[model samples]
Target: MRNHNTLKWMIGGLVCGLVMMACSLSGLAPADTGDSEVDLQKTQLALQATQLSIQADQLAATQTAMAVPAAPAEPAAPPTSAPAEVPTADETKRVNNVNGVYFEYPAWLASDVAASIYDAPPPNADDPYFLIEVDHRVFEFQNYSLADHFLTPLINVYPLEEYQRVNPGAAAQITLLKDLISWQSLGASRPDGLPFLPIFNAAQSFFTKVEFINTDSVNGLRYLTQFQQATYPIQNGQMIYTFQGITTDGKYYISAVFPESHAILEPYDDFEYTAEFEENFLGYLMEIGEQLRAEPDESFNPGLDALDGVIESLRVE
Candidate 1:
């Protein structure tokens, strides 16, 4: 009986030991799996947290870049100026004076036929003309014969005849003479006996040229003309001439003289001798007037009287 009891005790002890060992093993296995799962979850959570932190850092960097200010643009440059123009010397010295005039005479007196009537021929081949000088501002006659013959007759007879063919009247003659004298006075003062004529009755056509120049303290007006188809009646003929000149102080002076005669009017009964003689005498007067006006002797009475003493003293010897 003692042996059986001891054996039973030993068996019981072994059974208890095995049961404890089995329970412990089972518990250990489950615990190990749970621990592994928990560790994996922890690792994933850590990784996600790290990625969120990186994203926040990137956002902060972008905000900083956007807040920065942009630089300002530069201003435009200014424009340049052009150079000024200068005037020439000649342009500064230009003159302002200007004047003009015309002279007319019978065409017959300008031709050779008129020359035969005169004992002494005139100085210039072109007689019955006028002269012009810019310095003196004067126009003087060139032929005394032509002026006297035609000019005097027209003056004396035109008034008596009333400009008609038969009896020339004094009023008509004076009127014509005055008109002629006015034209002559355009450049200079006319002679005492010379009538002033402004209208060009004998001239068929006229031309003129003008130039401007400055004189000391005075403006000069220069005028020049070329006559065409001029006509006048002479002894048994018609007279024609060309004329030109400058005017100063409202007077016309002669520049050049020319005269020619052609048969136009027939001789009238006994009027021939008287007409011829009168024409010749008047022609001489015109010639003398021109000569006196041109270069009169300083010692002469009226000619010298018109000039200043100094100028008269300087006259050509």
Candidate 2:
């Protein structure tokens, strides 16, 4: 169980403070009363009234903040030491395993959602495999049903080109090829000399992070390759973090995707929602996007930090 933090959300409180200060400065009233002693006394009273009004306004702002409910704290990090705990003979859940690598999932890992298995492989196929969903899924497209159930941050036993060839008839694969072809067509709009880069740009836009980390071989099986990606939703504020690794046999792929609930993504805040602040948040997107483009570095993937011992202890037979 590991979690990669999503892009830090913009702080709306500073905007509120700046706006209130501006309003107070703009609302100064001039009292140019020139008269006798009584007039001076009247002017003093008026000055005191104005000062009290300002104080009341400031106090109201403070009180309003206290009245608003606080958002729950972000989830604590999970333990990712390596080779997550395996079920004892008595603890194994027979219903959840798919492919030869029996999944000994951590508590945080959800049961595999609807999984697809196609047995008929073309002659070049080297081994049997299974694709499973190990986290909550949200489709990128508007349709609630993916038709063939390929919502990603997914675990694919095979990469795209190979997965399609193996499962040619699967709806997900057919849709994937269609989308790939569609993205390819974007090149038509480019000036003749410009390189077509829709795939790269689209990936850059959707991904918040990409990480590589070391993995282990199990029982001389060589499924050591591993990487993780954190994706932010384009149409919504949801966050999806994905971890993908190959099994020791080099034939199976394991992925765990975590799509946070809306409450988790949209935390509670102090400021009253305003159209102006919303516009400012839109501008903040550019700043976050720049953060997203930082150079990739090699490190222990934070996504699996809590599941430290889990994968290496995988028992693939």
lDDT of 1 at 116: 9
Q: Estimate each model's TM-score.
A: 0.16, 0.31
| Residue 78 alpha-carbon offset, candidate 2, angstroms | 39
Top TM-score prediction, candidate number: 2
144: Cα error in model 2, Å:
17
- Candidate 1 lDDT tens digits, 125-166: 432111100121222222323332222111000111211222
The superposed Cα distance between candidate 2 and the true structure at residue 145, in angstroms, equals 20
Clash tally, candidates in order: 80, 18
Q: Which tens-of-lDDT digit does each residue in 179-263 have in candidate 2? A: 3233532122211111110011011122334333234532111111111111222222123334444444544333444332222
Off-target runs (Cα >4 Å) in candidate 2 are 1-97, 111-154, 159-161, 164-204, 217-237, 245-249, 253-256, 261-286, 289-304, 307-317
Question: Model 1 lDDT vs. the true structure?
Answer: 0.23
Off by over 4 Å in 1: 1-148, 152-198, 201-238, 245-259, 263-265, 268-317
- The residue-level lDDT of candidate 1 at 65 comes to 47
